[model samples]
Target: MEVKNKVIWITGASSGIGKSLALLAGQKGARLILSGRNTARLIEVQNALPNPECAHILPMDLGDIESLQECVRQALGFFDGIDILVNNAGISQRSLIADTHMEVYERLIQVNYLGTVALSKALLPHFTEAQSGHFVVVTSLMGKFGSPWRSGYCGAKHALHGFFDVLRMEHQKDNIAVTLVCPGFVNTDVARNALTGDGSAQTRQDQATARGMDPGRFAQKMLRAIEKRKMEVYIGGKEVSGVYMKRFFPRLLHKLVLRSKVV
Candidate 1:
């Protein structure tokens, strides 16, 4: 569907892929609600948009699950209705499972998986009433294949796939669509901001992430997938191949991941 005049609510809109998506969608004439934890940065993104007046900033902390229903209420009030909800607000992990604290795992699951699920659930009735809506989820390649030092991250992402798939199946009659966008690796602060064993930000970029696909380019492809209402789409460079390899050649993928030393 064309984004022109559509009301799109994007979480994690302060930077990275979410920021890029906001810019592109704004240029395409879509009304936007930009949500993230950083109110200042969200404002920066809004001003950067081609049509700042078409955008509204809704600061949110995804881990604050109890407030999501109220957040959704406020979001729907922005445009009277929302055509798409992009579940892109999430955190990353970069520590070995053994070394990672239990708090780190809880934070990962809360922010990356349960947060998205709660926000979506809160907005379900709106979609059902309208009989038309789209849920775009930004998971990761790790969701489909395992890699070292990201056990918790992988688990959270994998759970997104399972939950959203069932959401799609159950809501088909309601005409609500779900699109799972699995990104391999995109040039972003994901690595630098990733949580360590003690639940602290790593604050250092990894070489692979530093050399990943451009965020703008990735956002363009993602928007195309959303417009087509694809059930699932993988974006990024050659790392995307791992998804297929894991499906057909699990042993080979396993060996390659082990050799990569992904820390």
Candidate 2:
């Protein structure tokens, strides 16, 4: 679908891929509702938009699931109806599974999986009534092929595939589209904001992430997928082939994954 003049709500819009998408959508003449955890950073993004008047800032924390409905309501009050909802707000993980605490897993699921589902459910009725809406989910390649030191993050992203797969089938009659986007490591602040076992943000970015694709380029690719209304899209460097490897050679792929440079 053409994005121009469409009202889109993108979470995690303060920086990285979300920020890039918001600015690109603005240039495409789309009205935007940009959300993120940091109010100051979100406002900074809004300030940089070429069409700032078309972008609305909404500071949100998926952890606060209970209040998300109110947040959605406030966002909706500004526009007629959202043409697309980009479920991009999520936390990353780093640490061996054995070393990870139960609390860490709980927080990861709460933010990455449960919160995303809750917000989608809350918005379901509106989409059903309108009979025209799209859900663009930004899960990781980890969701398809797991790597080391991110047990909880992998699990949460994996869950989204199952849940959204079912949702796509169930809601097809309603004209509600679900596009699951699985991205490989892209150069972004995600690594810096990843949570450690102790629930603190990791201060340093990973080496691989620092050298990953530019956020602007990634966003351009993603917009094409959205425009094509693709059911799923896997994006990344050659490592992205690991997904196909797993499908064709599970046992051998498992061994290869065990020795992956990502670890």
Candidate 3:
């Protein structure tokens, strides 16, 4: 569970929480493999780390499911083996199910659910061979609950929890651990880049996200969860209750979320 000196692969490391985790993990003496679509931005993150040797950038589109196995192979070539796989690369949705096109849901599933699962499956053999590995999935609070306008996003994240939870049960003997991280809104470009009904970026930031938790602080909390090898960790400021509310007080929470003006 000790992160220091462990090899960690973090997807979506160009910015936001993934970037923050990369920097913090690098400072903590962990070997970091940062992956994302933006080579330039990933390199910038790599440079900002305290120890350059602690981190390297792997630039690729995780949404390209067909190439994920090759990506895993490429990663194995760089280091001895991957001790942790942080599945964080994902897109968000802002359109209602009625107004959304089929493709919007497909894209969300492809990038968030299918892509993560494929990459994790591709790396399963490595974890089994080594008899130890961690799968740290960055799901959303929406995964635990549902939002009115974010049906697709919510569904995809929900699927992730189910998949990883089962993977944990099935791979326990192999010493493989699966951690599902459910974070609420964080201050990041995620909202601005969220997809609309037409498969276009929302381009507008949500008021809630603009005033959400600091990405660095969120990453710090997430790192602690990973170190503990937690089964699941849900973190947020006030919005953390969204998970509990949905579980214990579904009616009140559902009505409140539907009526909330923030979204």
Instruction: State which candidate has the highest lDDT.
Output: 1
lDDT of 1 by residue, 137-240 (tens): 99999889889999999999999999999999999999999999999889999999999999999999988999899999999999999999999999988889
Model 3 lDDT tens row, 41-89: 9999999998877787788787899999999998987777899999999
Candidates' C-alpha lDDT? 0.95, 0.90, 0.91
lDDT of 3: 0.91
Cα lDDT for residue 179, candidate 2 = 94
What is the RMSD, in Å, between candidate 1 and the native fold over all Cα?
A: 0.6
Q: TM-scores across all candidates?
A: 0.99, 0.98, 0.98
lDDT of 2 by residue, 105-188 (tens): 999999999999998888888999999899999999999988888889999999999999999999999999999999887999
Ranking of predictions according to TM-score: 1, 3, 2
TM-score, candidate number 1: 0.99
Off by over 4 Å in 3: none
Q: Which residue pairs in candidate 2 collide? A: none
Better of 1 and 2 by TM-score: 1
Candidate 3: worst-modelled 10 consecutive residues by lDDT: 254-263
lDDT of 2 at 62: 94
Per TM-score, the best of the predicted structures is: 1
